[model samples]
Target: MFSILIAGRLPQINFQQVSETQFVIPISDIDHVNHLVVFMTGQIPFPENYGGGGNWPSAEGPSWIFLGKITNVKPSAIFKIGKIKDIESKIGSSLAPTLFSGFQHQTAIPTDGLLGISVEPLSQLDQQIQPHDITPSTVASNVEFVSKMLNNFVNYVTSFVQNVPGTSEQIVPLSIIQTWYNNFQRRITENPNFWR
Candidate 1:
C-alpha cells in the first residue's frame, strides 16, 4: 500500500514505495490512521469514491436508492501494523478497504457476537503515552471523545442480527467494540511491525 502510495503523492498519500520490484510492509502493527491511504494496487484506486454522483432531490422521489449496497470490501482482514510516534498503533494497508465507506450500514450479521468481550481499561497504555498539556476540562472532553470513538468502533464490530422480539431495531453489544479497540492497542504496542 505504502509502495503504491509513495509513488503517488506526499502527506496526502502516506506510503513508502521503494522501487518497481520491491515494497516491504510489516503486518498488523498500527492502531489508528487518519486521512491515510487504505488500498493501492496499480495506481487505479480500487473502489469508487462515491457511487452515484450528486445529492439531488432532497425529498425522496422516484429514484433508485442504494439500500445496503456496500456489503463488504475486497481484501478481507483490514489493518496493517505500524506506529507513527505520538500516534502509536496507527492503521496501515489492512485498513485500506474501509476507506470507501460513506453513508452505509451493516447488512450481514457478524460471525460471532463480538465474542462478548468487555472494554478493558486502556489507562495503562494512556499512562505510557500521556497526551501533552491537557486542561481539566479537556480531560472530560477527551474521555467523551474516547467514548464516541468506542461507540463508532463498537457499532462497527458487533453488528449482528438479534431480534428484540418486541422492538423493531436489532441489537449488538458496544462492549465488544471496546474490547476490540483495547486489544488493537495492545497488539500494536506488542508487535509494532504490521506496517513497517
Candidate 2:
C-alpha cells in the first residue's frame, strides 16, 4: 500500500491485494480534529477474465472509512458530514458537490465514520491496482487458473498414464470446477456426514 500526501494536507491512501486505501490515523496529529480512526481496503474484480462466470467487475481499488463530523444522522445509523478527517470517502461523484448535496445512500458503512456503502477510487487505495489494471484478486484465482492450465498440459504429456489403450483423461475448465463445487455443496448439505 502507498500513501500520497495531497497538497501536503490530504493523505490519499492505497491498498495492496484489495485492502483499505485510507487510514483514520487516529487524528492524533490534528490537534483540532480528534476522533477514533480506522482503515479499510477493498477492490472490484474484473468483470471479464476475473473469475468463473465473471462474478466481479474488472475495476480495482481500496476500501475506505473516512472520519467526518456527523453533519446529519438518520434512523438507519446514517451520518451526514462535517469535514473529511480522512480519505475513506467511499462516496462517489454521483452525490454531493460533484453531483448533489445530499447524504450518500449505501447499505454498509464502517462505524469509524464511513458515510455509505459505495467504495472509493482505485488510486486512493492501492497503487498496484487501478480502474483497469489487475494485480491479484483472490489468492485462489491465480492458483485456480494456473493449476487448471497445468492439469490440461499434463494430460497431454503422458499417454494413457500407463498404456491403458482406448482410455484418456480430459482437462476440466474453471467453469466446470465451479459447477462441481456447487453440486458438492448441495450433496454435502443433504447428508452433512454421510457414511462416516
Candidate 3:
C-alpha cells in the first residue's frame, strides 16, 4: 500500500497494489481529474538476454512505462490522454490525463518512483539518482518536455469541461497546476519520495 498526493487537490490518495508495484487509483475516488492514475515502480528482472515469452514475468507492467523508467533510472513521469464512454453513450469517463511514474535510474534491484502520464517525452524527475550521470542538457530537455505537456494538459482540461456531458465548468485550480509543476521541480531537485 502507498499514499499518493497530487499538488493543489487530491492529497494523500491511498492506492493498493494491482500487481507487484503497479497500483491503479480509480477515477471515482478522486475529486479532480477523470482518468485513472496508474502508478508503477520496481524493476522486473528480465533475463540478461531476453529471448521471448516465459522469460518475463506474467505480471509485467506497461512496456513504455517500464522500459522508459529502467533506461533513465531517475524517477520520471509520462501521461496518456484519452476519453472514456459507456455503452449507454454517457460520459463514463472524465477524459483526464493518466499519470505514470518510473523508478530512479536503471538498476537490477527494484527502486523508487515518480508521477505523470501521456505521450510527453520521458523525463527524469529526480536528479540524485546514482550511477547514471545525466547531462545538464538532458535535464533541460526533460524540463522543457514536461512544461509543454503541462500546458497541453491544462488546455485539454479546459476544453474537456466545456464540451463534456454532465460536467460543470469546474476548472482545476491554477494554484494546483502551479503546485504540480512545483512539486515536480521539487522532487527532481530534492528526490524526496515521501514514501521513505
Which candidate achieves the best lDDT against the true structure? 3
Off by over 4 Å in 3: 1-7, 29-72, 78-196
Candidate 2: list runs displaced more than 4 Å.
1-135, 160-196
Measured on C-alpha atoms, candidate 1 has an lDDT of: 0.29
Query: In terms of TM-score, how similar is model 2 to the real structure?
Result: 0.18
lDDT of 1 at 166: 78
Candidate 1 residue-wise lDDT, 46-143, digit = tens: 23332111100101221211111111133211221122222322433232121112222221323210000011123321222111211122566658
Candidate 2 weakest lDDT stretch, 10 residues: 50-59
Candidate 2, residues 1-196: lDDT per residue as tens digits? 2222322355435322222221121112333432222122223332222110001110122233221211111101112122332212332312112211122222232333222222333232222111111112356765765576556545544332344357685544555556555764564344322212
Which of the two candidates, 2 or 3, achieves a greater lDDT against the reference? 3
TM-score result, candidate 3: 0.22
TM values, all candidates: 0.21, 0.18, 0.22
Candidate 1 local lDDT, residue 186: 75
> Candidate 1: worst 10 consecutive residues by lDDT?
111-120
